[model samples]
Target: MLDATIASLSELGYSRTSTTEIVRRAGVSRGAQVHHYPTKAELVAAAITHLFHEQANDVANRLETMSDEELDTLDGIDLLWGALGGPTYRAALALAAASITDEELKPVVTKLLREFDETLVTNFGKYFNFNGEFESFWPIGLRFAFSTLSSAALYRELGLEDRAEEIVTVLKAMTSMTIKQMGKNSRQFGIQS
Candidate 1:
């Protein structure tokens, strides 16, 4: 049912995805949908949460299969970007836009988005270790990367698809330079691993 809701949101956008649509897509009874999710906001929230878990698991599995040499900030950004470009992310983006004017959904979406941000930070911390005080920057840096990539996706939706690679390339270069500076400062401050 949640998967059906995500599909509906991705295809129809937030305003048009009624419970009826989700039920039809899931091939489930309306009663079943109502039993699980009493409201559209609740249903969308559950769907986004489900997608978050799936994304986290996918990233973890990919990290587990990577060689040690492959574990770095740029590769991590690539992995994250891949997830961000998916249907689930598209669904979430649609809901995010609707949440702006939706009083009831605003809180729900806000809470879920905050949780997602924390999850991203935790996942990055588990898979990669920046040096010393630079480690403190991961949460901020990850959020910055997420915001930038998400904006890039919106730009793609607006028909600027050709600039996607350019945006990602510049993001990678900026991140790499920042990491290098952080490492230099860490070494200078005797904060070596």
Candidate 2:
């Protein structure tokens, strides 16, 4: 059902994805969907949560197979883009936009997004070597990368696929340079770990 909901959201957008559509796609009875998710908000929240966890796990599994030399910042960004710049993330984006004015869904989406942020941070921390002194800056840098990648994904959805590719390539270069500069000037900037 969750998979069906994700497909529905990706293909139909959040506003157009109905319980009936999800039920039909899942080949499940309306009663089962109703029993699991009583409202659209609840159903979407569950689907987004499930998707987030799956993406995180996918990244982690990929990281496990990579050697340290293959786990540079650019590689990390690529991994993130691979995991998030796709249909599932598009579905989540629809839910995120809908949550803006949806009072009932706002809190749920907010909470799930925050948790997802933390999960990404944790996952990156496990593989990337953010020096102990610059640990506090890790999340800030990661959030910037995530925002840029997310915007690129949106641009792709808007039919600007080439521009999206350019944005991602530029983002990778910019992020790599910024991290190198930060490492070099951390002490000069008084940015203590």
Candidate 3:
């Protein structure tokens, strides 16, 4: 059911996703779906939560194999773009936008988003390497990285693959510069290497 909801949101979008479509895609009865999720918002929220966990775990696993020296903003942006900027993110985005006016789903979606942010920060924080006075900028840097990369989804959907790549390349370069500045600032602040 959750899989179907994600698929529906990815392909059909939020306003078009219907219980009938979800159940049909899931190859399950309406009763089965209703028994599990009493409302569409609940089902969609759960789907978003499920995908969030999956993506978070994938990132954590990828990071586990890498040494600190092997990490950089360029590689980190690449990972984040590939990991969080495709169909899964599109699906989540749909639900997130819908949740704004969807009173029933708002709480669930907001809670899940907060949890996802916390998990992402905790899991990927070390790769950022913001030390000393640069620490406060860490979250803003990540938000910049993710929001910039994730924005490319719309371009890709519009068949603007080249444009999307161009934008990502530019953002990746800018992120590298920002990371370098952070390191320089940390050193200037007497943060030992």
Candidate 4:
């Protein structure tokens, strides 16, 4: 059912998603859904958590198969996009958008979002190591990279189709170049491996 919820939320958005739609898409009896989630907010929040956990596993599997050099290239952006720019993200984005007016959902979704951001940082550590404290610019740069890609996803979600690929391309280039420069700076300062 969570899968159906993710699909429903992604496609119809939070405002339009209904329990009936989820049950119909999931092909499950309404009884089963009610047994698990008595309310729409509960169901949607659980769906968001489920999708994020699935994304984490997908990212870990991809990281395991990718060579370090491949991970360091523009392909890294592709990997991140795979994790961040999909049905799950769209669903979560919808939830986030709805949260602004959904007092009942606001706290639950907000906590989940905070946890998701921390998870992203932890996931990055599995791929790369920094010798010491990050430069002040480091976190901001990383946020810029992710947010830029997220903005691209928003473009696609909003039907601004033409700019999506173009924005992603630019983000990939900017992130790759920034990573290279950071590596160079680290080596110059004897802070790298």
> Judged by lDDT, which candidate is best?
2
Report the candidate with higher TM-score, 1 versus 4: 1
- Cα lDDT tens digits for candidate 2, 69-141: 6666787888878776668888889889988998987898898888888888888888766776567887888
| Candidates' C-alpha lDDT | 0.79, 0.82, 0.77, 0.75
The candidate with the higher TM-score, 2 or 3, is 2
Off by over 4 Å in 1: 183-193
Which runs in model 4 stand beyond 4 Å of their true positions?
Answer: 133-137, 176-193
Q: What range of 10 consecutive residues in model 4 has the weakest lDDT sum?
A: 184-193
Stretches off by above 4 angstroms in model 3 are: 67-69, 182-193
Candidate 2 worst ten-residue window by lDDT: 184-193
Clashing pairs in 2: 133-193
Q: What is the lDDT of candidate 3?
A: 0.77
Residue 81 alpha-carbon offset, candidate 2, angstroms: 1.5
lDDT winner, 2 or 4? 2
Q: What tens-digit string does per-residue lDDT give for candidate 3 at 67-135?
A: 655565566667777785667878888887888898988888888877777777777675566666667
